[model samples]
Target: MHSPSVSHRNAVDQILRYLKSAPGKGLTFSKNRDLEVVGYTNADWAGSVTVRRSTSGYFTFVGGFKPEKPMELHCDNKSAIDIAHNPVQHDRTKHVEVDRHFIKEKLEKKISRLLFVKSEDQLTDILTKAVCGRVFYDSLTKLGIGDIYAPT
Candidate 1:
């Protein structure tokens, strides 16, 4: 923003081109045999070398006909999960004071349960990191997105 460069312009152009090519691409929801709301969260710790800030994201699924239980939220970062469940504060977690307390309160009320998930299985990875072609497609499938025009 301070100094827009040629690369930044090119990146914007590339995104525009992609959007033009896939104008119809989007998510579609349908009735299924199971009905449950599951959430997945992931964080890329220190992903940005410039600022050493982490990137995190979460996605939720609703309705499939199956019986539902208390919502379960899967997080790949054990530290963040621990912070959400732990009532004590520490120097290292001072940066996330607000989020810590909010998530802790939710957990205490049994509104949701936090569970650990391996990085590879974390679907939110697609939003926070650059993944391979296969992985990207897998993430799309997990998110219930697919090429509707493709032959079955």
Candidate 2:
């Protein structure tokens, strides 16, 4: 969700800088880690003013996987959940519907339950993958991204 003229490469570089500058800085998966994935997923749902397409994003975990099982995705969209739950062939969602299959199957196999998270609570915002320095640093701290940045 950025400017139309912004090239993907530039975006990738920006994200890379934030990640690399703070080298060895990341959320590590360790036995002492007590936190769950606490993931968030979101889509603009017809967000493209030009194409009417949506962009979706979600984060997987603290360690990135839970017990070798997929993380249960929480979402605020009932319609998306409906589309995901049914998995029937439909026109409106057909374009971006492929991602829903995993969740649908997860539900059927009792592997996941789509919990509803309020928009404000979703942490997906911090993960634009490209952001300004201050914004990047703010998100970094918010996600507990640094012992590296902590004052010495």
Candidate 3:
């Protein structure tokens, strides 16, 4: 089961609301906190029928504990992974020629790097599909969302 989340629906709106609603410029001085980044991503196996590309995205934030990029995406690619991964290219990859060339160039420039992640920990799936209600909530909750309460 998947639980509904306001954060997944409108990302831009979520960022704006977070910036506007957050208490202040974030506690840094006396809190003795260090800014850290946590990244996560997920991929759908051959999600696109038109090109047989996988839909995927990666995002980084301060682990919902500190202020950082808020909710900015580092990469959202449906057909670019093949370009990033050199070994994946074979006979079948010739179909998405243009995208392949472009993303390959980007990959060479250090613009992106591909990494493998397990399905059970693929947090991005919650946003990509209409999952069972409870399953969604459980995933998001485990990601330290909608449950963290900082005490004053």
Candidate 4:
């Protein structure tokens, strides 16, 4: 934030453009009786050509209002889901041991349950990737975002 660059400027411009395009679009969290919390998480491992670093994103929503029961976390990566469920450690999984253990702890405490979701159904993809137009709008609709100015 202290030092700005051309890339950062361009990114900001893009965000502004999106906001301008959807001036009345907003998310609606309706009152519900169910208290089960649902979440989606996705990671793009070593996706950047220059940095070779992973980009992780998650979308969590409380339908019932509170997490009275185990929070359902949907993920697209089978390996990550397996590692979170498995206790036996291997060198190959050491890189993500910290994250894995955190999730494992949550699973043990019944605070969260990690489950597999198809890539197409993973809502977090909109945050981590440049998806097709259909996917973009579909995800927004799923997330309860709507354009208030649209004709009824």
The whole-model lDDT of each prediction reads: 0.81, 0.65, 0.56, 0.87
Compare candidates 2 and 4 on lDDT and give the better one. Answer: 4
Best by TM-score: 4
Model 4: worst 10 consecutive residues (lDDT sum): 60-69
Local lDDT at 78 for model 1: 86
Among the numbered candidates, top lDDT falls to 4
The RMSD of every model to the true structure, in order and in angstroms, is: 3.4, 5.2, 9.8, 1.8
TM-score of 4: 0.90
Candidate 4 lDDT by residue in tens digits, 1-152: 68777877998999999999889999887886887988898879788676696788988886755557899999998978888888898899888788788889999999998889999999999988889999999999999999999898
lDDT (C-alpha) at residue 86 in model 3 = 68
Residue 46 C-alpha lDDT in model 1: 89
What is the overall TM-score of model 1 with all chains considered together? 0.78
Clashing pairs in 3: 1-132, 1-133, 1-134, 1-135, 2-132, 2-133, 2-134, 2-136, 3-133
Q: TM-score per candidate, in order?
A: 0.78, 0.59, 0.42, 0.90
Better of 1 and 2 by lDDT: 1
lDDT digits (tens) for residues 1-152 of candidate 1: 57877876996998799778766667888766775678998878889676696887889887764436667899888877878878779989888898888888878887778999998899999878889989988988888787756667
* Candidate 3 lDDT over residue span 1-152, tens digit each: 17545544686687688667644424232343645455666667678665585766655546435544322223344344435566456666788766777767655665444544555556677765557867776775666455223454
CA deviation > 4 Å runs, candidate 2: 1-6, 16-24, 33-38, 46-53, 62-70, 86-102, 128-144
* Native RMSD of candidate 1 (Å): 3.4
Q: Judging by TM-score, tell me the better candidate of 1 and 3.
A: 1
